[model samples]
Target chain A: MSHVNGLPKKSPDMNGNVTITDCGDSALVAKAVGLDAEAAWRLVHALADALDAVRLTGGHDVVPTYDALLVEFDCTSTDHATVRSVLAHEAARLGPHPEPITPPRHFVVPVVYGGEYGPDLPEVAAQLGLSEGEVVELHSGSDLTVRCLGAPAGAPMTDGPPFPKPVPRLASPRTRVDPGSVAAAGRQAVICPMPSPGGWPLLGRTPVRILDLHSDPITAYQPGDTFRFRPITPQQWDEYADLSLADLVDSAGLANSADLVDHHG
Target chain B: MADTLTIRTAGIVTVQDLGRVGRSRYGLPANGAADQHSARVANVLCGNDERAPLLEITALDFACVPSSDILIAVTGAPADVTVEGGVRPQWEPVPVRAGETVKVSGIRQGLRVYLAVLGSFEADRLQGSCAPDTILGFGPALSTGDELVLRTACPPLDHPFSRIPLFRLKAPVPPFPTSWTIDVTDGPDRAEFGDTGRRLFDAPFTVTPRSNHIGLRLQGEVPRRVTKGEVLSRGVPIGAVEVPAGDELLVLHRGRGVTAGYPVLAVVTATGLSALGQVRPGQTISFRHRTLDQAVAAHRAQRNAIDALRSRVRTAFDALRIRAPAGT
Candidate 1:
């Protein structure tokens, strides 16, 4: 088989591979061919990076999702054909296998499970045929990767390893889910960075402020980050509650205090 | 700086500009003026930058008292504009004296209206946009007793009310068709619906009350999809007509989330999206398929029309020795 950059070049017949298509007059979509979460993430990152390089010349934005990367450009200045050509050139440079521009960051998020913080915990556990404690163990014990930030600003969709049985979304969506609520739907887990209506089943609430508008880097988790839930007591949740973005960053130790300087500075 | 405008009866008003561009990657929706055409027109009438922040008022009544002499224009939904009890024409630039209360009510058509001043509104901005994204909890919604501050000082102009030229153009008037015919093109998931996708053009859909800036939920037969598997969540552009399992057609709008899981049957063309923005609840809508080239041409034409109008306004301003704000 022909190989480029140590990764096998996707054949046309491959069930789940990347294919580029026109999304609209000013946008193009590169969709991941299959249902595999890992493959989807890899393709999304690869295409997003390729498009980012292309955007150096012209392009408004490139949004990466679980299974696709949407590239938007100014139609008046650059046409879809030009963007496609740029993508093709970038693909040649990537050579099938492309390394992530930045190494994945890891986070340990402390979550308070059950009770008011997690209103749907018992229901989700019952549907999964597991005890409430077992449900918590299953969710927190597994390491998950940040698929992408979506649904709302700073809301991170994390891909958990396949569950023993498929989990379903809530038939009736709640009008509001509290901010910092940890929720699960199907095979994916998500952190509600803001209070918004959604169909995902609430599993817990984290004290971490994932979507801090006051912060320099508005979100806590970025794509390609690894995270695991650490069960915390309600008291611990209270202790961490009301912490500012600067405080959270300090606790995470990911960025230096100097990096927390305001935009005006 | 110019004195702030005091809100006397603040309806559902929020500051909006051209929207936050290039922030979809951070899961931020492009929340801007629901009707960009009207917003741009209002700004042009006021001699402000096209993307300057303006008040987006919903169906409810809005009343404000200016603290300084200001030039203003109201566009979008047809509404009665009364300046100190004197009726002023909608979609035309009108000058108001300081302390004169301007009341906008009796909306005849459309759902929202744009109110633009001669200069941009001073407000907290996120991602270079003043538009409020309630989901993200950024930017404030205008309320009774709130004050609206302007970015620039406005010195009273010495122009007579009779001499202020009204640059009239063929703009769409509302009592917006009870039934709307919108144009659309194939979406990324168009093939997922197979032959059933053709049904989209055959029937009319009613806009349900359970709709907001996020999307318009249509009451109609859900176009059937042959692919029975879960669609991975992906980026959804504005004007994407998605069909969830509930058998309702949901057309994403300006405030749509960054990503969605429903299968998108078609994407409304740029002109179609502007038309969709004016649709009121209980309105009936039908879709017509257009080729990609046709959609592009229509978008270009609409943009060119706006540019021509802007040029005319600029020429009028130059002739009258009126100073307009710089480019957006």
Candidate 2:
């Protein structure tokens, strides 16, 4: 992923109960700092609690900033002034962020690159002036972490190394992208959970159904969960195709190869 | 028995009360009526709690046979209602005889209709909600031959509105005017767009065929980049209007993906969100900008109106002296 310059600190003159930062467009962002994860959680929970206490009816939302919590309330039930007031007070009460959100955990999403599974693999490789296998190596060899799930909830954003040349998104999104299609846009790697229209450059696909709406936990990634990638050949994909859902579940264990490095198990 | 509205034909219907709460952590969409205001109004007319269980009908006919005579109200888009093949009224509460068939024709204007039985339907509430998010396999949509059980006996009206007979008097909920002129407020990422993007707020866009509960894909001048770089994908509220491809405007709705990567320009006000629900593919839409104060005022006004209606119903019910039917 292209490294962000990091959050620009608010200028002294702009300080207020809620100093708005010009993030872009006509809208402005309200920024606050939490000392640690607990503090962050408290800031998040307090605002949520207040929103709930007001009986504002809407779904709860979450995002991936370590030091901050993102809240969206029904504009009809509450205004930005009140919401900002509640959040800033809550954040100030909690303090600043701790170092241990630990830069998210890494995961190696095993993918079968090229052929029919990856419609854009050849195109991306050609653009990079590298062979398809080289493209796979470049992608799978790098370290990655779950940033946030976008578009589809549970669709994880994992960082990848810089492309040999930038791969642009499809000019026109396919009406339905196959589930498990490994796609890249900018420096982010995404695994499609369900068939959806997407612009990312498709590289390969995984056999794993990573998202289960009915699953108790729902999403596998936490803010700190890490991610890595491993390449599987198309033949391996074919072999797994005959397997039942149970067989696929069994295969997840076997897919863990000796090449895997464990910073933490 | 309480009041049972038997299904003759279920019409794309579902048993919805207030939606499941405290469950977004599990990735559940707060599935309920797209227009919560109308749903609450229907409930109030039927002498039920504002968020009581009701039938959410989508684009088709729904016929129900009431088990016990009770008051009922229909709200949302105006639809042709017939009882025993005779036209019925909208808005004001009316009594239906036991076993009488109530039929609502396919939406002539709006997409959904709310049917509140005097007493709500009884279902095992999952996480304090009867509204089902089918993605989670919570339950199936209401279909023909599905028997719904009402939990309490109907409270008899000493003088039912059926006399003044609010029948045939349909409250015309103005149909979504001209392809839905949705109101929006600037969001955190609105700054990501370039100056040209600011000009986009001045015009209207047409809804593309790709639009759905997930999002409204609008065809227009995609906003220019403000960040000149990428921003991390993050949590977005329903009705968050994002322009991802940099050409088309994507206005998220109730069923939008739980998260998103694209830059969001603004979020639509809650009062306008129901209008989004009625927006069909190929419809035209315009963006109206409002300050945060305007949004908050609109929100509070809607909430206050809903709460006011609720209290008024309570007062009316309290004065009626309707006894609990039989064995408690």
Which prediction has the highest TM-score against the true structure? 1
User: What lDDT would each prediction earn against the true structure?
Assistant: 0.76, 0.61
Which window of ten consecutive residues has the lowest lDDT sum in model 2 chain A? A9-18
Model 1 compared with the native: what TM-score? Answer: 0.89
CA RMSD for every model? 5.8, 6.9
Give each prediction's DockQ, rounded to 2 decimals.
Answer: 0.54, 0.22
Candidate 1 stretches greater than 4 Å from native: A1-17, A33-40, A56-58, A244-265, B153-175
- Tens digits of per-residue lDDT, candidate 2, B20-54, equal 54444334455666777678778877767777888
Specify the highest-lDDT model's number: 1
lDDT (Cα, 0-100) at A176 in candidate 2: 74
lDDT of 1 by residue, A64-177 (tens): 887778887656556665666565555555544455656455677789999999989999888888899988898899667788888867588888534577567788889888
